[model samples]
Target: MFDDTFCLNVRFLLNTQFKMIELPDNIAALQSYKPGKAVEDIFEGKNFDRTAILSSNENNLGTSPKAVAAIQEAATNSYLYPDPSGMKLRQKLAAKHNTTIDKIIIGNGSDGILSNIFKAFFRPGDELVSSAGSFVAVNVMTKLNNIPYKQAPLTKEYAFDLEAILDLVGPRTKAVYLCNPNNPTGAMISNRALKAFIEKIPEHILIIVDEAYAEFAASLSSEFPDATQIELPNVITLRTFSKAFGLAGVRLGYGVGSQFIVDTLMKVKLTFNPSIIAQAAGGAALDDAAFMQETIEMNKKGLAYYYKNFSQMQLNYVPSFGNFVMLDMSTEERAMYVFNQLLNRGVFVRPLAFFQLPHCLRITVGLPEECQLLVEKMAEVMTLEKN
Candidate 1:
């Protein structure tokens, strides 16, 4: 009996190797999107004398004074839960846009709202359609839900090829995604083009237009699409406080759509989708139109500063409507090398490999001095490369 027991134990021990199972198929198969490197990560073993992070396309103008004051006033009430309905902020948003409160639905960020939308609308066999080289989060969310995704290639000028995207849609297509003044490239769809495109799409398939960078574009051009113009039942427009409002850390974003779409999103959104502090800050930011205008003016000046430097360096870049611009590197390796060099120097700019444009880097428009410093550092790097 002892011998038999020993043999059984040995067999059980040996079986450990065979019992190692494969990882779950869902998350394992999904592509992970690389976000901007945190400022803390650049410190290494010792703190740098000067460090600035412009990688994430964040508002360079610091958070609004009014919003900061609002946060301070609300600090004592942190123990209490935020209102789940977000009624106050929704009402304010509606008043600003000349719409009803029920038409707005707030979320943790636009990304959260998007994920919830995918979960609420998509099924295992449904197909997701989006422009190639757009935001990586959309692709990740689609795969997480086991939805098949189809990429509609952009035009040579990096504009949304609406016709190409429409051609890809069929019975299985559930949603279409767009990042107007699109990330990395900063190309935008004209208002007329977008309106015509939406008119062609069926009511059942959703058209998600991400206007995260819309405020910056609003100041620069009037040709971009506005939510008020899109009256289609299929259209949903997204905006965020993380951009022009200088509240990236606060995580406030909202979706404006038909009442049916807003209701559908609320069904999947968590209780207290936005924190009280975030709501307060967002509302205050909206009230501070002067701050927003100053930010817009600074961005325009900074953009010009960078373009002048680009001209002198003879570096090619995509003309931008957003707060950032993409410079093309002859090879992906060179772009990555410049990214690493800048990070070591305590300036962080984003590499574009995550967005599938491996030979480019996206640099946010910072303060005038910051822009000058970035140009000086880039010039130094380029000179070194030639030697």
Candidate 2:
């Protein structure tokens, strides 16, 4: 018995030693981003021929024809290194935003720009302020840097409670992150409220406004906030091509701010961070104004359909200004159960327990057909639970 136990102990120690690779304290301790399951991972051996992924808020219209053609034309040049400055793309985007190219710095995605923003301004023990129920990336970034961030509670309506946010700010607060037309709940902070909040905040604190879903918010103009023209010294707005521009696979995004802030971030930004193809695709995507218009119109229709269905089913949902909506499940567990069942039916949506919103799920607006399939599958799943 002693011999057998000693042999087992030796094998266990050998395995542990092999697997215990050393890593940076922060990198080793970090809780990584939990990505949504890919279609292949969910249906590897199953007979599913078609899967509808509404989990990630991506453009369903596919890539713009002009962008696709540009990519094909540029394919031959892939062997050579791309322009480090990405000047042409920057010029075009600057023109689109009514700002000089110097005011924009492109990155892998809005998330990349966000990380740069954090790194440029944040350090250990610095405090960051954000809404309690927000995108997971905010928490991930804060924890990774060992920065202190307080989650200001949203109002009963799930909108940004500007007063609560201001109340939490202190001397250590280096930055505040906000998802204008916030994720999961889709509640937005209005321009008037933002202006008021800005007035109250200390000038030293930087405000990072992530507008990944801004095109959709613009479509809901009357209900959504006017984010285009809030000139503040410390405010930075991040936008991405992954959503309305249909360039998720290409992963391109940029941030718009005063030249001072832009230039400061550029100092720390990875040289040639945005890939050649991504920059080219982003520039081409912006040029396709007609495609963008169609996408806006379709998203409006899909959101309307979602609201009508929610009302018909007597389900409680947070009114959305973005391309997604949050439905209140009886419990977070129930929401998760429904999420799994939706997966079984080849429909994917997001669960928001990470944001402390356990009773809700974030469903992205898809094409009409995809939305219909999702609603039908949801109905079936809920009915089965009732039984």
Candidate 3:
């Protein structure tokens, strides 16, 4: 015969003690990664019937019909567990890249693959060097893992400063994370520059080239290097089906590296990381070459439209190789003002304050009509600012 009131009091005391427990120093100090605002949340109470979501750099043309069909087909077999090894997807990806299947490792997303790498290789106090104002995920991951990191400032043109990064590397440096066609700024390092930089890096250091936006950049410029094609054992390329493939919602990405590195990551990767549906969608997306081409073409038109309008307005912006452009508002206050104003008018763009580029806003290249709407809204917002 247990006393109910006494049990309740004891449980309450235990919960209070648990709440007071201290978190690890690194975990307590970590700042969360903030994604772009959702369209539904922004337009929840507003009377606007339509919204142009240019915040997240997603393909606005929607997922490929082939991928949708594959997903629908895969839904029937949800009862069984996913292929834990992801052999089929890995084989297809390896074939496409002209590499052995052992070189490919599938993940929930590129983020998941990165986590596996960090866990497998990095130790507390090991140095991880990266470009400041580049992809913020590397920084977040390093901090969460308690790995010491150093960031070199970007060049005047907002490109990765290879020289500064090289200088920062030392005996303790374990990894170097480089985001090609970098996020927020959308600047890229030339093939020659990248090769020269990689040559200077010490053999002990791992070179992580995150090419999530590689398809978009490659379409725009022949100078962009395909890291997987390079014969360097130390270099690992991270890619995703999220961007040009129009399969972001599927959460499928992969890493291409040497057999040794891939084997190491496999040990750390969770069993069945990517679901069955995600694998099917990714395979179908890769097969739909026509849809991928169409998405790239649409992005090109959107970029041209944005460039023409931004130049006409005499606004400063980075010449982007990726599917997004960063517009410099010249001041943090003005950027914030414009962001809120655009939201009020049913438009969403990513303000770069969290990424440490407070004076800039990153807008994704959506469909043609969406780009036109964005330009129109910007004109109205600027006019309102002046008056």
Candidate 4:
């Protein structure tokens, strides 16, 4: 009996030991991406009656009425599984872009599509080259997947250094990511510069142009290149309903690329990645051209308000093509101090330390009232700092 009991105990110990698992070194070493703080979380216990969430560059004008109706209609059919292929949404997206459905790929969001691209095209040691201080997702995903990443510094005016980025592209570089109307700093590359840069890139390396803020950029500048209009074999343009469509909560986005690249990305994408409701909402949003125009107009007005105020105050800010502007505080400490003060005043703006622009704070263009409040709070904060 004693021998049998000891043998069972030994087996249990061996099984437990075998079950212990270690994550890959790359994943184990990764620092997770931090999204903008939620309004509720930030304002908890604060006595402020009003809050302007200007941290995330969301469409404050709200979701399209048509999208809302579509989402409501789709709710009743939630019992059925979503179409894994996302055919209908792809059809709508293709029609909108004047392309075939075969060249379109949809995912949970642009971020998910980006992940699939990284997984499908890159190997463990392959490199991704992108602008320094651009979107954080590319950096996060590369580190998480054990892929090497190289960053080319932004120009002195906070625009993409296209020549520097081209210099960084080497033989093992699998992809180049260009976040047009770049985040944190809403600076953009003109059509001429972008076209030249694309032409100079090697055919083997894929160019992934992330145009999350493309609509706003296009409205602000006639020179902004619409990647969809560019017929490069190596280029993939990513767009999302999260911005202008105001469907961020719906989590729908797509990639337009060559048939070959789309096919490969489909293999890595999660089945039924975007739900039926998200698909329906995206289709409806595309049709709601009036809502999109209204959102753009509101953003333009808000940006104009900010420009006037910043100019009057003599505070330096990037002339933004996107819906957000970055204010330079002259020092990281000052930026942090202003961020905290703004938070206390019930205003939320993004601090840029994480993006390595330590002395800057990114403020999304909010509603007219919110924009006024943001400017007022900034003025107050600067005054307090001066004292």
Candidate 5:
């Protein structure tokens, strides 16, 4: 019984209003974070071993036995809201780092800390500086906030170009971000270099040292910088439980900084972050020293294994301080070829295109047998590619 002309006019007016709703440029420009291909997406129900997922640099050995118990115990308390301040976890972190509780800030993960970092310190005109191929989260955060940046290229050896980054610092540079033992590439800045870099940074500008892989580097090398020891008012060191602690599932991380920065971040951070389960897991995991030591040793051995095998194969790779090694397959085409080939054989390794290293692939160290399986399958892919 509705009139066709009336319905058409109403529809036309509605469509016009919907079409006029434009997204802000900053939001519109964002490229969604697309991580490496998932095993399920690649296989699509094909019969394959599900355990060969080495793409994300996740735990090779299992979660800590103690943390597992803690997680179960905490789950039963799901009816309760988490402590809004996350004081308990922050207290443990403070004690471990020889800092007061006021100096630590907990988050859902280091990424959460980063989100707060931008919110607390950055302004419209502030320019952040870092290397081009560092963590992509910086890209997303900066662009989302409409913040401009200055970028230096990584050194030929695939390390942060400290001097170049320092050179980029100027009046407009309000912050500098460094990812030590950087993602995908896995090279670390030495303690001496880090010190020199920090000393030169103007006190007015903040320095964010993202040590997501610090545990692995410290275990393997004597000279790795302990950013926590710097004690500079402008310096904030970020770390996570996800990597070396094997609690990636729980998503707990924190930042160590001056009381002022900590207080500022707390104001911006979400209240009740890192729910009850995460806090319990992190606290219990910290007590399991044996488990952490075993993880560090395994990562050390795994990196060495990768170095020896990659050398034997005559493949060019960056020496990695982190758990994963980056392979330069010489071209993006070849990297994609090997990546697809590995997936077909039930192996999933990371292709670094999104990390701006299109010709490179990052392979995490698996168990000894899984490592062997990958090498064997890689050899097959190499032969097939040659043909």
Candidate 6:
């Protein structure tokens, strides 16, 4: 409708308006979470056939056979939108948890569901409490939602400091986030401690128990607490098929809570998430008991190997209940040196500095060959460091 001069003027005005729109203060202050590097990323400069990505705590055994099959079948129906409610997957999850479907909440992943929880439930002046070095995602989520996050230091054993956390729970606190078999450290609170902590929390405070690695922890430790089994109306138990189920690529996770809480979360959740293939994969993965057992057995063996190798090398390491272990490198500088050396050797691991653990690094338990490679590379690096 206008000539070239008018068009140029309009373009300049639009650009100026767009530039003036700034991110919210909270989001502006956020530091992006650093994820594990891909095999390609680590080996980009150098060409090497051997590579092990023990970074993201993914299952090294590949995708679940049952889930792979389901994914393939679902791909044929990709033209249709995913079920808004994710009914079939919810039904399966509810059955597994021995709860009704209304109590179940599914999302793109446990992290996705966690973000939705913040949006739906968290409000200004609402403080969230947790352990200091627990999960970095919680740190990100709190800032993302502008929720006031308070934390107590971890216990000497690296488990959640229940007493300290409870002491920090003030009248302004609305929720507590606990990551059992916590990420990076893989430390878990015993069943008794978990129960005691829950009882101490005020009834109005929502306790979120994120058991992402619960299946592995339960398999490895008799003392592991399954929070979903507690059946508390105020407690929300979140689990994911991403880890032990070997469905990380599919990104399926769920939460078990009261029906009212589920409804509230549903209102904020994306209408169509965890697409058709993901939902189908999740449903099938639940039935793959043999695969789960294999994952656990492999994880057990891999962890033992890492512990033994680390011990022989005189490196301090945390005994893990999950599929990964944390190695204390004595200082942030040492940790970064180890990380860079491993990266050069085509072995990618995660640095825990951002997890408030600057002196440690996390390594996922890979397959037998991969584990051996990691040990060999670590030995070489440490030997060189000493020299």
lDDT of 5: 0.88
> What are the per-residue Cα lDDT tens digits for candidate 2 across 1-387?
669889779889887543577887877788666898564486567676666788778888889998898888778778877777778988987787887888878888989888888888886678999888888888888777778889889888887787888888888899888888888788888777777777888878998888888988988876455443566778888888999999999889988887888888888878877877887788789889999998998889988898898887777889888888889887988889989998898888888888788888888898889889888888898689879
Give the alpha carbon lDDT tens digit for every residue of 1-387 in model 6: 799988779989887543467899999898775687645476776786788989888888988889899999999999999999999999988889898999999999899999998998877899999998877989998998999999999877777888888999998998999999899789988899999888888788899999999999999999998888777778888898889988887888999998878999999998999799999999999999989999999999999999999999999998888999999899999999999999888898999988999989999999999999999999999999999
> Would you estimate the TM-scores of all the predictions?
0.91, 0.91, 0.95, 0.93, 0.93, 0.94
Candidate 3 Cα misplacement greater than 4 A, ranges: 1-19, 31-39
Model 4 Cα lDDT, one tens digit per residue, 175-244: 9999998997999989999999999998889999999999999999999998987776788999988998
Q: Write down the TM-score for model 2.
A: 0.91
Residue-wise lDDT of candidate 5 within 1-387, one digit each (tens)?
579988778889888543467889999888776797555476667787543778888777879999999999999998999998888888899999998998898899898899889888987799999998888889888988888978999999888999999899988898999998899799999999999888888889999999998899898788899797779899999999988999887889999999888989989888778899999999999999999898888888778887887887788999988888999999999899889999889888999887888999999987777787888888788778777
Candidate of highest TM-score? 3
RMSD for each of the candidates: 4.1, 4.5, 2.4, 3.6, 2.8, 2.6
What's the count of clashing pairs in each model shown? 0, 0, 0, 0, 0, 0
lDDT of 1 at 178: 83
**Alpha-carbon deviation at 322 in model 4, angstroms:** 0.9
Clashing pairs in 2: none
Q: After superposing candidate 2, which stretches have Cα over 4 Å from the reference? A: 1-25, 32-37, 48-50, 226-228
Better candidate by lDDT, 2 or 3: 3
lDDT of each: 0.85, 0.83, 0.90, 0.90, 0.88, 0.90
Per residue, candidate 1 scores C-alpha lDDT tens digits across 1-387 of 669878779889888543556666887876566686456576566566766677889888889999899888767788889989999899998887788887898999888899888978887788988788888787777777878889988788777788999999999999998888899788888888888888888889998999999988887888977764466677789999998999999889988888888888989999976998988888898999889998999999988888898988888888888999888887999999988887777778989887888988999998877787788888888787788
The C-alpha local distance difference test score for the whole of candidate 6 amounts to: 0.90
Question: After TM-score superposition, what is the CA distance of residue 34 in candidate 4 from its true location, in Å?
Answer: 8.7
